[model samples]
Target: MKTLGKTILLAALAWAASAHAVFAPGEKVIVLNSGDGSISIVDPVSRKEEKRVPVGKEPHHLMATPDNKELIVANASSNDLVFLDPKTGDILRRVPGISDPYQIAYSPDRKWFVSASNRLDRVDIYHGADFRLAKRLPTGKVPSHIAFSADSKLAFVTLQESNEFITIDLGKQEIVWTMPTGKQPAGIWMTPDDRHLLVGITGESHLEIYDWRARRMVKRILTGLGAHNFVARGDGRHVFLSNRMANTISMVDQQTLEVKETFPVPGGPDCMEITRDGKQLWTTSRWIRMVTVVDLETKKVLHQIPVGKSPHGLYFQSHAPRQ
Candidate 1:
């Protein structure tokens, strides 16, 4: 009787774990393995890697369609965009001829699709409907990240190699302004109010806040070494930043521009995804080939999920807000 009771207890615990995630049949988490040129589809409920899906060469970053129907993976070396079914991780289609698309995004107004050709030092703008190239503006060396104004008329880009930041007038397809910034600016984000832009300086230990309207940097917020990337907590009040070199993730209050919580995570942390309920934080640990999962409620590193080499970007169908 004791043995039977023990088995039932263990089974009950397992059910709770799966129930908490509430994953459907095809629901899974997608991770971009940049070094291996593939993607890992993991079962979120079981937290086990389901399969490795081969994709284009050097798959670096990914994002969902503005309508959230499909997920797009940017393959830099292969110069293509592969669209995947958001729920099942199946390849829907591939659009080729995108030149060195290291990072890509769609503007807030859904009027433009933008790609940064990192290796070619160019920013390519495409018509939202067909993704036909509207204009390719030559930028400083290594255009790394992109953000857009709420109105979708102004697009901001960071040049890592040139240590500069620039804004392009989408209507004219020309760079209206360019200014110097700290070394190695990688990830760029706009604040909730869309008044200021936050730049992650990968070569330093802090981030620079730029007032795009005033055309000047307003302040610097010291996060940690190699502070890069931002993901909001879905509450619209908090944003998380990952410090790759420091192996830490900092949660900053957007209103105060101050970090409220700092949690240590092993391996070089890169891209992040938080659960919809805002209880768990998932980040790709760049160096260790592992995805670090943190229990936000307890502020503890739960466990790391092994994936592919040099995992860079991560996403799931049910996740927290980006802004």
Candidate 2:
């Protein structure tokens, strides 16, 4: 098998040369949680590790600032958030006090970074620009993941224990609505139009679509096993789901509510991110201790780049034009 970086496929053939929508040239970055108290920075296009920075422990998820200059990582074991410089992989700041910060999301305006702490059963909000503590909002129990509306007016947080999705009004910084969802929904994502929220049924391998305006379940799609992380294509018609237990990725059609295709991945793929150009879909395999890059259009594994053990999460820098 060809190793990552060594094997290069024709970007035109792989992506149909459709203006390369995923990662921009000369300006792409990859963030991976080592799952052993460290985080590594890699250039997605070059497949080279820039630096490895140590954190508290078991970094569960990560989010980059709006400008893509700084990265905030959730250290689940230590119950804190670690901030770092993405280019050099240096620790710049560490925010302590969250309990089991498992997942994170940024507001549409990118002004606030919100985290869901499973152990503390609360949601902690941080000012993105200054990295300051804004407000800690309490939830029902075991908040796993969070998502923000496109308008940045509201945030939907999944409370695993309560089996409900809590809606927080960003302006008031408080919970305004609670909508019940499937059992143990772990990850939450919003559709491109911001008209629906997709809740992953972590316990049973299913996906539930909730209409934002109607505030109810519209459709439920059956995926195979331990569905966790989800990523949507730029067109908003296709959504990719990671089946953690099955070691595979499933492509679902949004309009038809059907799984269009499934492809094998390296160990159990946890979290995934597609390049800004849409040429590739990258996933971190925890057990295999590597990052798997797949040609989304071909549905074939292009290369596997080795990283630290138990890679938990992956984050790609959004494309930004030069200032």
Candidate 3:
């Protein structure tokens, strides 16, 4: 049944028809306040927070559906998902009973959804749009982030506390192997060609590049202290890495595996989103409780909009690809 899984056609069509309410101009940026159990909607024009709405507990990460119609916020402590209007940050619906969904994402193939239960130390594989649980596999500890192969046949999860990375064979519904990572690996990313896997070492000051097909570390680039998360540059040439301890973010060449440049950003940059034209960046500053806007051309912060405590994840309806 896993191989034969498919989304309900009627439901997808209905949702597509109703999606006209989204993708409007003046789309707001949504920031998840993990410490406050609420979210802030920022007016893109003024670069200020316009409104704050309560969502759920410990909402750490979020992503758009494969169809790009709805935004899914994973409320870790609440153990549920809150779907919202991608354009306005309005509540669309809630799906409960998901256990400890700290970081959630849908595979590129649109065949599977994965939740990394950081607290429960497990990974749950859900099939299709209904998100029915298909398998529960326990990881060692603190599964922090996830990235999938382009074909979506494999899922790579980083265990922050265990210092390991694991790959899930989606077709088999099982983890095929576990390998050692750097100290406190948090963010995992795959090159577009799926040739390399970049592991962010949060406990260290560098990134470890692994050849996934060869299952070995190929290169290590010194980024900054406590490299924690990643965001694509939208140009397809480079990707940005945030270093919490160093208070800086490094831009790395995706092909050459070199640190092209590093820029200073204050207060522990976590998750990030970019503008469609690739000129501006909106990132969450966790320790400082602010949503920062940076001018990519100058590599300087343009505005630091105060929101709530511990803003972790961020998104906007019109933005660059999450590559």
Greater-TM-score candidate between 1 and 3: 1
Quote the lDDT for 10 in model 1.
94
Tens digit of lDDT per residue, candidate 1, span 1-323? Answer: 99999999898687557535545556888999999999999887667898998998999999999999999999999999999999888999999988888999998888899999999989999987788999989989999889999899999999999998889999999999997898899888888898888898899988898888999998898889998888888898888899989889888887888889888888999999988878888999999999888888888887788999999989987897776
C-alpha RMSD for every candidate: 2.3, 4.9, 11.7
Tell me the lDDT of model 3 at 206. 97
Residues 49-149, candidate 2, lDDT per residue (tens digit)? 66676777888788776767787788888878887776455689888876667888779798887878887888888786665778898889899888888
Write down the TM-score of every candidate: 0.94, 0.82, 0.92
Model 2, clash count?
A: 10
User: Candidate 1 — which pairs collide?
Assistant: none
- In model 1, which runs have C-alpha deviations exceeding 4 angstroms? 1-19, 22-25
The best candidate in terms of TM-score: 1
For 284-304, candidate 3 gives per-residue lDDT tens digits of 999999998888889989789
Task: Report the poorest 10 consecutive residues by lDDT, candidate 3.
Answer: 14-23
Local lDDT at 61 for model 2: 82
